[model samples]
Target: MQETPFCLTFGHILPYSMSDSNTTDFTNPSTFILLGIPGLEKAHVWISIPFCAMYAIAVLGNFTILFIVMIEKSLHGPMYYFLCMLAVTDLVLSTSILPKMLSIFWFNSREINFSACLTQMYFIHCFSGMESGIFLAMALDRYVAICDPLRHSTILTNSVVCKIGLAVVLRGSILVLPFPFLVRRWPYCRTNIIPHSFCEHMAVVKLACSDIRVSSYYSLSVAFCLISLDVFFITVSYIQILRAIFSLRRRDARLKTFGTCGSHLCVILAFYIPILFSFLTHRFGQNVALHFHVLMANAYLLVPPMINPIIYGVRTKQIRDKLLRLFTDKGT
Candidate 1:
């Protein structure tokens, strides 16, 4: 949020190398380098155009969905309530990295200040974590709607939904806030160039010149706790969902139910599968998985927001109709 007067990303490399210390405490740097996206094989202008377009579309599209949900009384159902949360999370998620990323790509300015890096990491992880939770809540909503239609209203009550939203906030805030602080507390005397596009925790930690054993342990532990918990819940939910889907005898009824859950299930797989692989690769450090690992990690971040709206737009009649109405309306 700091404007030009407080411009923090105007520096060369750090004075210390990884040889000096195995730890990096968060000392505010003039800028940290981004050694990503730039390496992608494309003309600078070509990549900038597409990346900027994607950022613009991500914001506009997610914001429009949020606005439509807020203004439309008919859209006040639990499904839409969750959808609004998803859209808002998408907007927040993309905003965290896109602007800085686009700026870097366009201006060849990869240097991000230490405080800026920490700030970016905090929200990026927060929204990313929040999205994982929201997806789980969404799957649960689908399950209740499909399997126990009779109890849908009672199970997903107004207060219950509020609690779910609160859980999303608390989950991200409580687990992730301590991380940037811990990183900042460490002393790093190494090159400030980040291997990835954004201030990813693991990547940044690797740059530290001092003993980072505790930080690494706690950070990895926190990551495992959140991601492992998410995967477990999502897997259990889908198992029950599949069991219910298969148990139904009516073909037409089955197809109808599939129509409702298909997109959601697709979204769940799209979002979580890559993330699981990313985590596995990080933990095991298999050299063979390097390229594929980064690819999966990027997809876990970029693909979901891009694909979620498309899935909902194509699969849900209500969402499609609403989008159509917006585009076709005579007055704006």
Candidate 2:
């Protein structure tokens, strides 16, 4: 007696036996096929061009930020230390998806081992959460500097910064640690083809043969709880920062104070806006195109990493001066 094959459709698996040799039995498939943006498969080659460019820029830009902060002794403050953490997080986040994504586009390597897929899923979410925590840390640094300038040094000391970094890592890790384990418990006795580029949490969960409400609820809860709290704290910090800026009588002083936060604000918007859009669209926007959601998801991870260093270099006077001096000395 031939075993029945399973087909996954619309987030449910239906068992159906087919005599056709082409219909592969994906029940407990060892490797999953990642269809890189299902509807726009033909355009994957064209899409790879920009994705590749963004990835290159992100790697170079982040490495540049890390190098500058490391070499410039004056930049060894709590703020720059936080910036370094952000840069590292951005690098890990983007790298988690792009290399395999590019391979899927350029080389037609769509199959990813199940274990590898799970690992990818873990790293992407872990680093994403860490990135948000880093943003919150950066916001706190700005708030302290602007609102309590005299005590900023004493408050955000080197030891305190180290502790904050550790906390951010542990928080992100502990929150996202359950993802892979939860996913591993399910039996993926359905079609092992994921429609997006990478192994996203919900995407992989939808392939499971069992009830996915646990995975869905946990993911939603984690996302909402972590992001909401981070955003709330960041908002309060900035509000206090704004109050401090407004309290200064001199217009120039106000401008200077607010200008210091400009880059952090831009980077925060770049990070959060696309992520929120993608998350909401994925969950609620059923009418929206699948390709659009995939593109936005990829964009959120790639864009911030690519442009963060640019925003900082352009908006922060110290970084700009240092970058210019480095280039000038090289040219000479």
Candidate 3:
């Protein structure tokens, strides 16, 4: 939607008047333009190649993990159930961004309606919080298996796992549900170009014409509080697990115990470090390049989905052997 420029004669000089019918009003809906990776116009084509590849791998890998876990009776335990949930979250998170991203990158289709933009923002943030919750749940599962091996089964029964899953969903939904409603109430009278690949909370809020103090403060508080709590619990769980491992007399016992948690640790580090860096850079680093911030935000979304399954497949022998056997059977 291009604006038509015109000039009006006043007293001494003629003033420029531009007609922008698409510009939003306080009473009506408007569309937003998503500018994917500012200052990278020349590299959009090259950048999208790797993004497409990673998205494909994430979809294939996570679905493979889900299928294997569902079909294998041995993998029907609590740990694997948590893994399945993680895969589902990764799939949802990846799908929420990639299709729109590819459309923007490849087709230059960047105009999104207001309601649609808010929906994307809501789900992306919601699923991200859910992933953090799932990580905490996985941490607890490992802690129980390692620190209280005798009661692991009793503590994490099917009913308990279902409850944990429901709690994760509710925690994420309750915290993130207010964001879209807040944004909807804001009158966006300025330019609606969001300088990011997706509809991020801050990026969208920055487009508002009204005061956004509450939106900013509340969103920041919710994010930090949730992430801090999850990380705190995960840290405590790992600390106790390490203590339990150290108490074992045999080296083999200690090695085997730590091995069970290695894949999860790899995933946690991969997921959290980039996310924390992205958020910190966006909120605090005034001198950071726009392209760098955009890249990090995207990595925070895409990298974990692409790498989690690979980590589990490579490190967990049960998954590895099952995958190999499945491939072998398909060939035969």
Candidate 2 C-alpha RMSD relative to the actual structure: 4.1
lDDT string, candidate 3, 1-332, tens digits: 22111111111121112237435344335777777877786688899999999999999999999999988999999889989989999999989888988888888888888899999999999999999999999999999999898999999999999999999999998999999999898766535667778898888887666678888899888888679889999999999999999999999999999999999999999999998999899888857877798899999889999999999999999999999998899999
Which candidate tops TM-score? 2
Residue-level lDDT tens digits of model 2 in 1-332: 22222124332321122233314444456777787876777898999999889989989888988999989998989989999999999899889999899898889898899899999999999999999999999999999998888999999999999999999999999999999999888876536777789999988888776777888889988998678899999999999999999999999999988999999999999999999999999888977877787899899989999999889988888788899999999999
- Which pairs clash in model 3? none
Better candidate number, 2 or 3, judged by TM-score: 2
Give the better candidate number (1 or 2) by lDDT: 2
For candidate 3, what is the lDDT?
0.85
- What's the lDDT for residue 130 in model 2? 92
What are the Cα lDDT values of the candidates? 0.72, 0.85, 0.85
- Could you give the C-alpha RMSD of every candidate to the true structure, in order shown? 6.6, 4.1, 6.2
lDDT of 1 at 15: 24
How many clashes show up per model?
13, 0, 0
lDDT of 1 by residue, 106-212 (tens): 77676788889989888888888888888888888988987898999999998999999998889878988887988887655535666566787776766665677
**Model 2 spans with C-alpha error above 4 angstroms:** 1-27
**Candidate 3 residue spans exceeding 4 A from truth:** 1-29
Q: List TM-scores for all candidates, in order.
A: 0.84, 0.93, 0.92
